[model samples]
Target: MTVDAVEEPFRTQLTVRLRQGDTLLGVPLPGPCTFTSGNGIDILWMGPDEYLVLGLELSRESSDLEAELSRESSVLAVVDVSAQRNVYRLTGVHAADVLAHGCAIDLEVAPVGTCVQTLLARTGIVLMVREDGFTVLVRQSFSDYFRAWLADASLEYVS
Candidate 1:
């Protein structure tokens, strides 16, 4: 009998929030789809009233993401989402196809350089465009199940 081993990919999540201020480290924040960059982070404008700060791997011990901004005398609230999410980067030629099985939104129309928060297989998900693939963010509790589902959906391409 032959033993089969399945190799899964690696993933990580980073939750980012910013302080309400006139500027972020001398760089002014713009309206709509604008972004501000500094301190190894990219602040993305998600909506008229919402923003998402993207950064490197954050430390689990640092529960307060707004501490730095707070110290800078900016009005901001700390958002603790350490246990709320998981992030995965999906590559390969079949990346879009794998997502098609779960996501209702058309990837072709989504276009690259855009970020969308939608549902996948009835679960909430955030999709980000990349040069060669896409990044998917989902709640932590559903990560394992989502990964398994993704593997099954990708079987056609893997074979």
Candidate 2:
């Protein structure tokens, strides 16, 4: 199993627009090029004042999460974009190399907890560096193509 790519669907995904230094939501908004994980959720910094909140718990409903986040006065907007993207877990030692085949970012120096929004295989994606592996978030429309590309890119390392 050289870079296993498994789709993780139905996870709660919220696009949050908040002020840069607001900590009212309890979840720390990570800075550029980083993510903060805790309480079964990961907050990925998408832009200077925007973040993608991913609920690590697969069973959680996006509506419930969205409602909860919406109550925060500091949050400018809480959009439930759960269905807009599909989560893919890419594991194993060759995972980074496989991603590098299409991504321009140098993954070698990206420490765990690093997250960045970029193009992978020409598909826009949000990649989070994790201890076990890497978590890839790709738009649903491009999921199939990205999956095929990942498989093909990792073919040489399967043996």
Best by lDDT: 2
Tell how far residue 80 is off in model 1, in angstroms.
2.2
**Candidate that scores best on TM-score:** 2
Residue-by-residue lDDT tens digits, candidate 2, 64-131? 77887788877889888888999989889899899999999899999999998899988999999999
TM-score of each: 0.70, 0.92
Q: Which residue runs does candidate 1 get wrong by more than 4 Å?
A: 1-39, 58-65, 71-75
lDDT of 1 at 142: 86
Global Cα lDDT for candidate 1: 0.60
Runs of candidate 2 with Cα error greater than 4 angstroms are none
Steric clashes per prediction: 0, 0
